[model samples]
Target: MKKNYFFSIVALLTVSLGSMQGQVVNGTFENIKDNGLISNWGMNFFTPITIDAETGETTQDFITFGCWPGFVFPSWDANHGQHAMQMTNGLNVTTNTIIPAKSILFNDPKQDIPGWNPGIPVDLSDQVAMLGFDYKFTRMGNDIAEAELVVFGTDGQELGRATVDISQTNTQYQYLYEPVQFTSFGIPASIQVSFSMAKEGSVPAFGSTLIVDDVIVSYAALANDEFQSTQFIVYPTVASSEINIVKGSTAPSGNYNFTITNMEGKTVSNQSIQLSDNNPFTVDVSQLSKGIYFISSKGFSTKFMKQ
Candidate 1:
C-alpha cells in the first residue's frame, strides 16, 4: 500500500506541472489580436493613426511645428481640423486608432528621422507575471536605439525602471521577462511602459521611424514554478546614497546570494546574507556611480537607479 501511495503522488505532481506549463504566456504588443487581452495601447504625435492590416505598420497623419512636435503640444496643427491632430506620434495627440507604416516608409524620399514615444500602463497588483514585445529599427542609419519599461505608482511616482538596447541588424524579435511582485510598488494604481527612437541630442526627423508590435502581459500559472517567490521591498526607491530592503513578507528564509550588476552585465557587488524573518538590510550605494543597476536575488531580479 505504501508503494502505491508513492506512485499516486508522482502522478498528481506530473499533472500539476503540465497545467502550469500551459499557463505561462508571452505579454508583448504584437497586435491586438495577438495579445490575449489588451489593457491599453496608443501612438504618439500624429492624429488618426492608420494600421496596415497586412504589414502591421503604424503611421501618423498630421505634422508638427517643432522638434518634439509629435503630440507634445496641443496648439500646433498638421491640419486645420480640431480632431485632425492625432496622437500617433506626439504627446498632445493622444488617440485610440491603428497606426500604419506604409504611409511613412523609412526610406521614403520625404522620410527624415521621426521620433516616437509609445507606452502602456496596467494595474498588475492582481497579477504577478509580465512580458513585453520587442521593438526594432531594421533599416536606419543609426544602429543604436533605446527602449524602456517604467513602473509608476498611482501618485505618479516612478517605482522602477528597465532599459534595453537593440541592434539594427536583428531580424528576430526579442522578449523581456519581468518576474516581479506587485506589492513592491506599494499599491498598484498606475503603471506606464514606453518605447522611442531618435538621436541623442536632436529631435527625431519626420522620416526616421521604428516598428513596434506584439505586447503581451499575463499572470504566470503555478505550474511553471518560475513565479517569483522572493518578495523584495526597497524603501525610498529613489535613493541617492543608501537604501533599505524591506523583507517583511517576500523575504526568503535561509541563505541567499545577492548580486548587483550594471546594464553591461558587469557585476559591481555580490554577497551572501542570512536573512532573518522580515528583517531589513541596508546597502550603501553612495560610492557607486549614478546609473541603472539590476538587483538580483536567486533567479529573480529588478532594476533600480542611483541618483
Candidate 2:
C-alpha cells in the first residue's frame, strides 16, 4: 500500500500540527466564565496546555470554537454600561480557515512564556499616536469586517499599523479612528489588537457580524493640522474662572496653535496665538480643573464650560 499510505499521512499531519500550539487569550473580551465566553478571545483555536507528569505543573484550557460568537454582550449589545464584543462569520468544519477572530490586550495572554512575550506591553514612547475603537458592523453578502492595530518596537520591529474595514452595513455604533504613522526610529514596545469578522477570500454567506466597543489607546494628534484656525468664540458660557477668546474674521491670519481640551480628551491648555486684526484672545482656565473645555484651534472647535 503506497508505503503504508505514506506513514499514515505522516502520522496524521503530526497529530494535527501538534495539537494547535496553545496560549494567547483575553483582551478585554473580559474572560467571562461563559454566558457568552470571551476569555482572551479566539476563533482559530489553540489554547490547551496541561502538563504535570511528576511535579511539573501546567494548566490552561478553552479553545474549540470554530468561529462566530465572540460573545460578551450584556448592556443590550453594549456601548455604555455592561460590556460589548461580538464577531460572527461562522464555519470551521475542517479548515478553509474561516476562523482567526483574535483579541489580546496584554498583561499576559500567554505564549511561549519564559522571558516575557504576549503583547500588552505598551510604551509608545511619548506623544502617543493613534489607535481608537468603538464599532458596529453587519454586512451579509458582501461580507467584510476588519479592525486591527499593530505596534511593536522593543526590537521586534514593526512599529505601527492601524486598519479599519467594514463593508458598510452599520446600524449604530461607529467611531473607528486609526492613525499611527511611525518612523521616529523606535519606541513603541508592544501592542497587538484584533477585531475581525472573518474575511480573506471566499465564504460570505453566514451572519457576517462585528461589534466591538471602547478600546481607546490614546494620543491623537492631527485634528486637522495645517492651520485653518478660523472661527473663534468663548465667553462666559459659564466659567467660575476665566476664559475669553473672540476672534472672528475667519480667524487664522498668522500665528496659531492653541489647544485646551478636557472632556476626557485631556490637553488641559495650550497656547501660541497672535491673530493680527487687533486683539481679542485670552485664556487662563483660571486654575483649570473644573469641567468641560475644548478650544482646539485651526479647523475650529467649540464647547466651553468650567463651573
Candidate 3:
C-alpha cells in the first residue's frame, strides 16, 4: 500500500510539471527596434523614430507633425525637459529584456490610449493577467496627476481599471501588482492587454513620467480539473468551432480513441487515432452543436462546449 501511494504522488507531480511547461505568451515586444518590428506586427506609428540596438537609443524626429500630433499616444515618448527617454541598461541587465519607460518624457494625462480588447460576444467573457515589470514615477516639478491601468474586453467594453496618484514627495517606486478579473465577458479565446496614464483635473496636465519594465502575462489552464494518469484537455469555457487538446503524459506507444457525448448520455462524435510518443492533439468542433458536451479517451473524461 505504501509503495502504491508513493508512486501515485510521483505521478501527480510529473503531470503537474508537464502541464506547466507550455504556457504561451500571447505577444512579446522585445524586438521593437526602430519601426521595423513594430510596423511588421501591425502596430501603427504616430512618430518617426530610429532605434539603435547597440546603445539602446531611440530618437524621434520631433520636427515631424506626426511625431506628437494626436491627443492619444500608444508607444513611449520623450521630450526636451531636462531628461529625454532612453532605454536603461540597469533594467535591461536585471530583466534580461529591454524595458520601456526608463527614459520617459513627462506622462501627459490627456494622452490615454485603448488597452486590451477580448473580441467576443458575452459578459464576464474573457479573463487576462499580466505579471512582471515595475513602474516608478518621478515628480521633477510641482505637478500632480493620476495614472491608470485599463483593461478592455470583447464587445469593446471596459472590464477593469485601477488608478494611482502621483506627487512630488513619494519616494518608493510603487509596483503595480494589481490583477484584472473579467468573470462575465464570455470570450473563450485570446485577448489583448494595455497599460497607460491618465489625469484627474485640468491642472495644465503636468508631464509626470512613468516607467515600465519586465512585462509578463499569465493564462488559465487548458483543462478545468486534474486529468487521470491518462487524460487531456480542451478549453476556453465557451469554445469556438475550433478546440485544442493538451496532452498530459510523455510516455511512448499509446493508442487512444476519442469519444464525445451529450448531457443526456447520447453519443455525439467519436474518432480513433494513435498518439506519437508524447505529442498533443487538436480536434475540430466546428461540426458540433451549441451545447455542453463530454470528451472521453483512454481512461479519462472531460467536458467542453461549442458555441
Candidate 1: segments with Cα more than 4 A from true spot: 1-40, 43-165, 168-230, 248-251
For each candidate, what TM-score against the reference? 0.35, 0.26, 0.31
User: What lDDT tens digits, residue by residue, belong to model 2 across residues 90-119?
Assistant: 444434344434333334223211122334
The TM-score obtained by model 3 is 0.31
Q: How much is 127 displaced in model 2, in angstroms?
A: 3.2
TM-score of 2: 0.26
For candidate 1, the 10 contiguous residues with the lowest summed lDDT are: 9-18
Location of the lowest summed lDDT over 10 successive residues in candidate 2: 9-18
Residue 306 lDDT (model 3): 66
- Tens digits of per-residue lDDT for model 1 on 1-307? 1111111110000000001121212222211212221122323222345566666666544433223333211212211112111112222234422222211101111112122322223444334244333333443444344445455566667666555544454433333434333434454433344444442442333333444433323322221222123466555444678866655365556776779887566899887766677677888888778755667776555555566
**What value of lDDT does candidate 2 attain over all alpha carbons?**
0.51
lDDT of 1 at 37: 17
True-structure lDDT of candidate 1: 0.39
Clashes of each: 42, 3, 15
Ranking by TM-score: 1, 3, 2
Q: Positional deviation of 279 in candidate 1, in angstroms?
A: 1.3
